[model samples]
Target: MEANRVDHLLLHFFVIVVGLTAILGKLIELPADQLVAWRTLAAAVVMGLVFYRVRFFRQPRKVILSYLGAGGVLGLHWLALYGAIKVSNVTVAVAGLSSAALFTALVEPVITGRRHSKLEVAIGGVVMIGLGLIVGFASEFGLGLVLGVTSALLAAIFPSMNKRFVDQGGNPLVITFHEMVGAFVVCAAVVLGRGEPVHMPTASDWLWLGVLVVLCTVFAFWMHTWLLRRMSAYTAALALSFEPVYAMVLAALFFGEHKMFSPWFYLGVVIIVLANWCYPVARKRQAMRQSAE
Candidate 1:
């Protein structure tokens, strides 16, 4: 039980890391597309070293393609997510992304070919209410809101793919390694096609980029992989859902007066967090009852 508690705590920390990724993107003054291209490139380098150490790169072609698919999702997710930060402030971008679990609820059933669970839908609806509040308070929605939502939907695709790939005997580390590479390739192609030189980031830009790659991308994903091994998937996903709450708090702390939204914003966040946190618990209970029945 104590081990479970620790795993739970670590997953929550992962949420914070992802949430704060937007802050890093906002602080660095670069085009969102270019930023994602560099981030994917950096993450690929880190994953490559890990790949060599694990010797997981020796896998067959089919397995490698699976990694590329996952990576494609990863690339698109970052592209949209960073684009959200570019078009809007970090507060609105993060708030909009809080709807990820709602997206997941809908996508998971279709992908897994399982009957849609009522509890999951209910929880998703609740989270939507929370998003409504956040958007209500921050009424200056723009292209960023649409991009943020798309980013989140793309993010939902990867986790389920992770589970499927692992279940099919794919190497987790290799999957991550190749996915990062795939993301880098896709982003680079997009950046280059834009007919602009890859914006050469300065020392300070590199510094913040390192923080994002090391702390958020590398460490966060590694911790999440570790937690997945120790805890149930539902528990892991539920804890991960707190990303918006964690992000919003950090935005307020870092941005101070500027990040502060109206009272409606706080209320919306509360509603969303409540929905995200409650969804898994409800799912777990339903599973237990089914077992007994």
Candidate 2:
């Protein structure tokens, strides 16, 4: 098989791995804040071993502080994600998170100061209709959907922030470690402030959390970046957008979550995913039309 083909397969595999985060969040019996605290702490400790030899931490204090602040965003992002799952099922949570692809269209330009693409704005209209269907029909999960969309909005900002660090000659691994440490600090503080002890993971929770830390976060991030190196920017972005679809499919398989939704809810999901998948093709065609003209 061709190398790009192999990369494509690996890319989807990583998407599947990311799909697991929502599932594990549902399985683990902990509050969202503590779960994030534990996840960030474990991830930071593991990344610390990798960081001990490399001095990416040697970047200027200003940049280090910025990544740490950004880590707070990452921590909040996960908190919202898990919160969505705890309040609703994984299907609704991922459906809400699906809006992230559209939110990226809105968020990225504002962050990067690039002019908005008319095509993306048009795509957002379609996504909004899908979201309306979700909101109107699955209204019971309204809070969860709101948090999921909030998570999506935060997800949109994360990469643009990381890109600045990468441009500043900081390695991704080091940047991630700093973010993890930052997130752990924020999450731990929140956990402590709640007047509850930092809850230890149950044996079953530990099992799920282990899979989460090992496969969903670390391995998924490594494989995603590795696949990006081998594929075009467009292919990589497109591959990542399919994550919601994969997550929904996994939810159905694992939890029979499909039975809980009305037809309109599924219709909304289809619309969002289709709009996401269509954006790249639409952009490419518009580029071709402009070039030919």
Candidate 3:
């Protein structure tokens, strides 16, 4: 039980790290594509150096290919996330990303060939209502919300794909490394094909990007993978529900993001966050009832 509590705390810490991505995204001056490209490359290089002894290519060709594919999805997810932040404030983008659970509820059944859970769908509907409220009232951030939602959808896909690879005995770190490489490749190609002259990042930009690559991407991700083994999935899900909350709080404190939104926007954010937190509790209760029966 004590171990569980420690894991829970660690999980929350990692979620906060995840939340910081939005702040970092907004702080960086690079275009979304370039930001993602450099971030991924830096992370890949770091992970490659740290796990230098691992034989990354020893995995089956099919597994390596799967990681590469998932990596592409992961790359797209970062692009969409930063793109949202570029167009909108951190609060709007983070709020939209919070809808990942709703997307997962809808996508998981189809991917796993399981019957859709009515309760899950109902909860997802509530989240949709919340998102609708945001879109309706915060019309200025409509495009950012759209991009954020796209990012959430891609977030759902890559995790689902990663689970398959992990279940096949693939090393999580190696998979992450390849995925970073994949993201770098895709983003680099997109940036190059745009035919825009690339402006080099200033020294300050490199400092922020380094923090993002090391702390937010590599360290946080590694902690998440480690904690999942020690805590209940319910615990992790509950902790993650607070990511947008953390982001909003940080935004308000640092960037004054709260001043940019109407009261109704906060209401919508509350609703989405409540739905995220409640779904896990609801699932736990349902599981208990099933076991009792």
Q: Estimated TM-score per prediction? A: 0.90, 0.90, 0.91
- Model 3 Cα displacement at 88 (Å)? 1.5
Please provide, for model 1 over 5-90, each residue's C-alpha lDDT reduced to its tens digit, 9 standing for 90 to 100: 66666777787788889889988887988898888789878777655678756888888887887788889988988888888777
RMSD of each: 2.4, 3.0, 2.5
| Candidate 1, pairs of clashing residues | none
Candidate 3 per-residue lDDT, tens place, 1-293, comes to 22355676777889899998889888999999999999999999999898899887787887777777878998999999999999988888877877776676667556535567778678767877887777777788888989988998887666656545554556778788888888888888889999888878889899999999999988876676555445433345435657778999999998988888788877877887788778768978999999999
Which runs of model 2 end up more than 4 angstroms from their true locations?
A: 1-10, 223-241
**Over the stretch 1-293, how does candidate 2's per-residue lDDT look in tens digits?**
12465776787788778888988998999899999898888887776765578775678899889989888888988888889999888877777776665666676667656678778768877877887888888888899999988987777676556545554556667777888888889888888888886678999999998889878876676565445445433344445556677887888899888888899887887887788678768977999999999
Ranking by TM-score: 3, 1, 2
Q: How accurate is candidate 1 locally (lDDT)?
A: 0.75
Off by over 4 Å in 3: 1-5, 112-115, 227-239
lDDT of 2 at 6: 70
Better of 1 and 3 by lDDT: 3
Ranking by lDDT: 3, 2, 1
lDDT (0 to 1) per candidate:
0.75, 0.76, 0.79
